[model samples]
Target: MPELPEVEVVRAGLAPAVTGATVISAEVRDPRALKRHLPLGADGLPGDDGLGGHGVRLPFEAGVARAADFERRVTGLVLDAPRRRGKFMWIPVERGAGDESQPGSVPIPLVERGARDESKPDQLALLAHLGMSGQMLLRAHDAPDDRHVRIRLWIEHPAHGELRLDFADQRLFGSLALDRLLPAPDGIDLIPGQALHIARDPLDPAFDDAGFLLALRRRGVGVKKLLLDQTLVSGVGNIYADEALWRARIHPETPGTAIGPRKARELLSALRDVFTQALAEGGTSFDAQYVNVNGQAGYFAHSLNAYGRQGAPCPRCGRPIVRESFMNRGSHFCPKCQQLR
Candidate 1:
C-alpha cells in the first residue's frame, strides 16, 4: 500500500492537471472498484443526490453495467486541487456549473486552502485508496488503455487538452468513491468523511507534538504498533516505522509507556526527518506497483536503512540487521543499536 509520502507524491503530481479542471465524464470498467460508493436503488438507478442535489446528474450511457451513480455524480463537477491526509487522497468539487436549484449560488469553500466558513454548504469529493497494486496514471486520451484499468475519468483542463485519468489495479484491492467532504475534528482542514478518523501525519504543520508525546507515554501497546495506529498518528507504516525506531535507538516492540518524553520526542523528530527525506526522494518504491501519476518509480527505496535490509550491515553499527515477523509482515532492525528498553 502507498504510504503518506507516496500518496503525497501522487497528489502533488495531480494538482496542476486536475485543479480547476472539468470532469467531462466517467467510465466504470469494473464495478468492484466502486464498492465504496453509495448503495444503488432497487431500480438499479441513482436515487436522490447525496450531495444535497448540489450537482446536476448528467445523462449516462444506459448500455454500461455496474454502478451508474458513480458516473452520474462525478460528471459536470469542476475539481479543486487534489488534497491528501496520510494515505488518503481526494479531489473536492470546486463547483457545480449545471446546478439550477440555487442559481448563482457561491461555490462552497474548499477545505484547508480555502476560507473556513462553517455556514457554507457541504461539498463532495472523489476519494481514492490505493490498496496493494493500484496506480493512478494520467494518459493521453488516445493512448492505449492500461492493463487492468478499472476506472477512467475524462477530464478537460482550461489550458491543457482533454486527458484520461486511469485508475488501474492489478490485485483489485483499491477502490474509488464519491464521499462527502466534512470538516475535520480540528476544524482546520477538510477531509473526506471516510477518512475522518485518521490523525494528522507528522509532517502536518498542525500535528501536535506535545500532545502526541503525552499520549505516547500513556499507551501500553508496542511503540511500533502505536505508530502504525491511524488514529494515534497516521501514515507511519511498517517501512518507515522501523527506520524511525532505528534512528531513535528504540526497539520495535518497546512498549509506548516505557518510553520517556525525551525518547518520545526523539522518535517524533526522527519520523518527520524520515518523511521529509522520503518526500524529497519522491517515495520508497520497491516494485512497479507504486509509482507517481507520471508512472515513475520513487528513489527513496535506495536510501532505506532498516526495512528490507535483513542480514545487511547496519550503517550506524556494524552489526547485521535482523528481520522479525510483525503483523503478518517483516520488521527489520539493528539488534545492537535498537535494544529493547
Candidate 2:
C-alpha cells in the first residue's frame, strides 16, 4: 500500500546503492509478484525466455548490463518515476520485442543507459507495476529484514562493486508494468491511453489545471473511487485520497461529478498537502504491515485525517470522524465538515 511519497522514498533509498551498478542477478522471488511473468518455483526464475528459437539472454548479461545502462542513460531514476498508469508502469522500451511472435513483456531493456540503438530487436523497454503487497527495495544482502522483502537484486559495479536490493510487500497486491518499453515506429505510435493517462495532477507544480477540472466535471463515481483511479491522477491511493477529501471538507461518498471547481481545487491542494504531510508522518502504516523498504513503520499514520482513525475526533471541527463502507472499501470522513449535501 505504499503510495507516491512512500515510493519516492524507496527510490531515494536506492540511488546511492544500486543506481550505478550492474545487475549481476535479478530474481522475481514470488511468481505472483509479477503480473505478466509466468509462474515459477520459490525463486521465481524467468521461464524459458519465450523465444526458444533464439537463444535466451543470460541473467547477468542482460540484467547487470542493462542496470548499468539504465543508470548511465536514464536521468531522474526514482520510485516516483516508475509509477502506475492505470495499474501499470509505462517504461520506454529501447528496442522492439525480443521474439515479436510471442513477445514477452520487457518494458525497459538492459541497454537503456548504453548508446546502442542499431535495431529494434536489439533493445526493448519493460513496464512493471508492483502489485499490492509487492514492495521494492535496494540494500546490501546482509541488510536485515527492515520490512517485507519481495524481489531481490544483486548489482555489481566497478566503482561501488556490489549490493543486493529487495522489493517486498505483505499483502502482495502491488504490481509492475512492462510495456514494450522500446520506443515505437517513428511516426507510428501507441494510442492515447497507452501510457500513464493521468487526469488531474495535484503534484505537478506546473501540472495541468483545466484538464483536472474537466476530468472531474462529469463522473458519477464516488469521490473516493475517482481519486483512486490512476487514470484520473497517478499515485493517489486510499490514504491520501481520504486525507485530501477530508481536508477539502468533502465527504468520500460525494459523487465526483457533483463536485464544483472550488471543491475540486481545494481537494487538489489537499492532495499535495496530505502527501507532504504524510511523508513527514511516516505515510500511514496499516498495522505491523507496510513498513518502509528499510523495515521501519511509516510515521504518517499518526497524522492521518481519516484512514485507520475510526471513531476518532475530527481535528478541525472537533466532530467525530466517521467510517463507513462504500464500493466495498472502508472510507473515513468527518460528518460535520464533510457533509454529504
Candidate with maximal lDDT: 1
Candidate 2: residue 68 lDDT (0-100): 37
Query: Candidate 2: which stretches are off by over 4 Å?
Result: 38-128, 143-149, 176-179, 182-195, 198-201
Put down candidate 1 lDDT per residue, 1-341, tens digits, no spaces.
Answer: 58888889989999989998898889988766764565344443323324222132322332132356677667778989898887888999855576434433333333322465656555788899887778889998899877889999999999888999999998767778877787799999778888999999999999988888888889998899999998889888888999899889899999999998889999999999999999999998998889999899999999999999999999998899999998898889999999986
lDDT at residue 140 of model 1 (Cα atoms): 87
Q: What is the lDDT of residue 289 in candidate 2?
A: 55
**Local accuracy by lDDT, each model:** 0.81, 0.56
Clashes of each: 0, 56
Candidate 2 residue-wise lDDT, 126-150, digit = tens? 3444444555555665767645555
lDDT of 1 at 292: 94
The candidate 1 region of ten consecutive residues with least summed lDDT is: 51-60
TM-score of 2: 0.70
